[model samples]
Target: MRIAVTGGTGFVGQALVSALLARGDEVWIISRKTAQDRTGQERLHYATWQQLEQNPALLEGTDCIVNLAGESINQRWSAKAKARILNSRTDAAARIAKLVGALRQKPATVVNASGISIYGTSDTKTFDESSPAHINDFLGSVVEQWEESARTIPAERLVLVRVSLVLGNRGGAFPLMSLPYRLFGGGRVGSGRQWMPWIHIEDMTRVLLFCIDNRDIAGPVNACAPQPVTTDQFGRAIGKAMRRPHWFPVPAFLLRTLLGEMSSLLLQGQRVLPAKLQQGGFDFRYPTIESAMENLVGKSSKPSV
Candidate 1:
């Protein structure tokens, strides 16, 4: 199969590309800048989405398309940064919709990235594809709009993965989230009652592939683990994995002062569970926090003290 991935240079994208290649699929990456020739492999190709839109041949014979393009949401949300966050996702989704509309042969499926943040900060309620979106904050609004844009694309199967916090060694949310813990400066943010939905990076990549291969799955699927931990529990788990002492507690006001509105990402969380994936018979590689963290940090290394 030929898969075209937008934002294929990102952390998740890089891993996904490697996974697809291992399974013998041709991968094409769409990025604003030219992709570096690190692999020196012809199976992987790169081009800009604008160029691809101008020339439909770029998408021709493409079996599937994954739209993962978007700006990072971790920074302080200044007015300009907020607009960039919204526009980057919506605009990219719109572009993909247009490309699909113009394609002489539409792809069989389109898997676009959404987020569990669409549910906003909530209690332990488990949300599935049928759950109504919570549009109370900027992150929720961004995800709502992002998914709406992808809905415009007419395809046989449209999948919106409301992904949880992905834990990996290199990038995405893990490095930043675990940094304080590694430094033995970890603690629960705010009340520590908020639920944290997380998935191992490997599981996330596999779930994407599962969605691509399975035609029956569509709509908003929770790309998270079965077990959702509270913020306090998450801190302790990381500390346990790193051999660090989870003692301190960061006050909400301090976090708010430091991160501005972006502090909500840390202060509040959702207990997202992969109900659809489990129901669909997908087995996770690392279902528990302990195993997941061990895989990430390695077994031989001592936990930070």
Candidate 2:
């Protein structure tokens, strides 16, 4: 299969691309970097975002297109930074949608990335794909518009994957979150009561591939583990796994002052469920925080994959 991926060099994208290459699929990466041989995977190719936009026909015969391009929301949310965050995501999806429209042989599937933040931060609510977007906050509004930009993609199956907090040894949120724990400064953020929806990196890649292979799986799917945990619970799990103390609770105001609006990424929480994926009979390798933390923190949590 020939696949085109935007943000193919990113954490999630790299994992997904590696998995695809391992399965002998031809991968075309859309990025700013020049093409190079990766692990002798001669089938791997790279093209700039401009290259694809200028020549949409380049994606002509692609079997699938996965868009994971976006600005990182881990820093201070300045006016400029917020604009970059919104534009990076919306523009990437819009560009891909345009490319899909221009292609003579459009891809069979187009998986556009989103986030569980669409449901907003809720301590009392458990969200799934069926929940409505909470357009009240920054991240929520961003996700709403980001997915909206891909509404015009002309694919047989258009998948909107609302990803959650990805836990892994290599990359994603676990390292940063676990750092304090390892250093004996770990504790709950805010009230530590916010629900955290997370998935193992392995499961994250697997779900992307699952969407590509399963014809019946279309529309919005929550890419999270079945068992979600509270922020306090996660910290304690990490503390135990790392043999550290999870006692310090960072004041929410301090985080707000430090990160500005971006603090929501850390302080806010959501209990998201992989309802569609589970109902479709997908099994998760690490379904609970205990299992995920055990694997990621057991052996120093070094970058793997």
> TM-score for each prediction?
0.96, 0.96
Q: What is the C-alpha lDDT of each candidate?
A: 0.87, 0.87
lDDT of 2 by residue, 1-305 (tens): 99988888889999999999999999999986676665677889888878877887777789999999998888788899989999999988878877888888888899989888889888898888888888669988899899889887778889999999887767776778888887899998898898988888999999999998898999999999999999899889998888889899999999989878777877778888899999999999889888888778865554455
Task: Give all candidate RMSDs, comma-separated.
Answer: 2.5, 1.5
Q: 1-305, model 1: which lDDT tens digit per residue?
A: 99999988888888899899889999999988766768887798888866786787887889999988999987889999999999999998998888888988899999999999887677767666677888889999999999988899888899999988888877887888889987889988799998888998889999999999998899989998898888898888888888898888999999999999999888888777788899899999889888888777645633221
For model 2, which pairs clash?
A: none
- Runs of candidate 1 exceeding 4 Å displacement: 301-305
Q: Residue 211, candidate 1: how far off, in angstroms?
A: 0.5
lDDT of 1: 0.87
Q: In candidate 1, where is summed lDDT lowest over 10 consecutive residues?
A: 296-305
Candidate 2: stretches off by over 4 Å: 299-303
Question: How many times do residue backbones clash in model 2?
Answer: 0
